[model samples]
Target: MDARFLGIPELVEVPDVAVVVDVMRAFTVAAWAFAQGAERIVLAGSPDEALALKARHPGAVALKDGAPAPGFDAVNSPGRLRSVDLGGRTVVQKTTAGTVGALAVKEASLVLCAGFVVAEATARLLRTRGCDGVTFVVTGEDGQADEDLACAQYIARRAAGTETDPAGYLHRAGASRAAAELTQGVRQGVHPDDVALCLELDRFPFALVAAVEEGLMVLRPHAVPSPIEGPSPIDGRPL
Candidate 1:
């Protein structure tokens, strides 16, 4: 399998498989939510979309702009959700990077959201599926970020069956300016612990595989090979 990394949301020709990376918080939060028993996560590309989804499913947890939307359960903060009960619930997350990147590639055969939490599982799955061409989309707000880049690099290398040193990438991720700035975004109610959670590598063993149905992006938890149920349908509700 051949893999390439692309920045921003451009689709000159979307690849056969796209792995969207948003290590700062969005995808990472979704991973944790799934681990804590959330059934599925809907990746709404904008705040208004998330709000509209909430209007339909009033009990869904809505996260917008890295903060909890008013009347929502929690923001895009893994730490905040650490103690919250998410079993059998649907999460509507609208982020500046993660969801935007996932939504941009409308033509990809497969779309999976990633962070350090699901890096290894994602790589293994890609190899198992025998993906011919893979594009790692880094949804960096400023066009690039260490957290996103590191996660992409890890997956790209692992998919190619190459040895990877995660320590260096993890270090870069924790030391990136984005990590520092987001930690201080306490002004936006972002706690420092949330930044730490984003940097925790390989915290989970499953990836969030997505599918577009009726123009909406929906994600379901995916694991390696036999246990995997392929991707979610656009209109399929979370499990």
Candidate 2:
């Protein structure tokens, strides 16, 4: 169970048992929607596509999308979704990061949806499954900064049976200094709170495990191992 950090595109060659992450929004928002009792989530790569899916499944669900281009229900914002009610309905989400990364990893043996919000459950799933050659692909705007790196470091430490003082890795990864100027950093400008959210171990129990059906990324909540714990030296973060 060897683990090392690789840039997003660098993941292509590795055998992927990936837990795709986009904590700032995307995946994090999905976790929230699931927490609110959404039955399933479909990760659409673009806003237009998500709307189309919603149109096809109207009255039974809600659809949302966000893109720099106008006309989306809303941009990917967890804060925006916090007050919404999604009881018993599925959600279709389209974002630039989470869904795209999930789709790219469709080639992997096991692709589980992950975010800072559910870091604990994710790591628990990985340890329970005993994954080999795991890859964490960060889908930046064009693939850059990728807060998934924080979640990955958390998982990498656990997979190898080691401990990582995140402050230490943040220093090593130079995220500390970068944090100062991060109001304008990589992968479409991720904020400091994004880092905090992505690393909150065991905050939720949502994992979007899925595959590309036909051409769309379809997701289902993965079964998480029981009694998830906080960051641990033995089990680490998931996937």
Best by TM-score: 1
Q: What's the lDDT for candidate 1? A: 0.78
Question: Candidate 2's residue-wise lDDT over 1-239, tens digit each?
Answer: 76555555666563568777665567777776766667677777666777777777664343443333333444455555656777777687777567877877777778877765676566766777787667777555444553557666776666565665655543432353323333354533343464444345557754567777666677766656566444443223343
TM-score of 2: 0.74
* Candidate 1 C-alpha lDDT tens digits along 8-120: 64556767789999998889888888877787788786777788887777578777664445655677777777878888888888877788888887568888889998888
Residue-level lDDT for 55 in candidate 1: 79
Pairs that clash in candidate 2: 116-198, 120-202, 122-238, 123-237, 123-238, 158-236
lDDT scores of the candidates, listed in order: 0.78, 0.61
lDDT of 1 at 26: 82
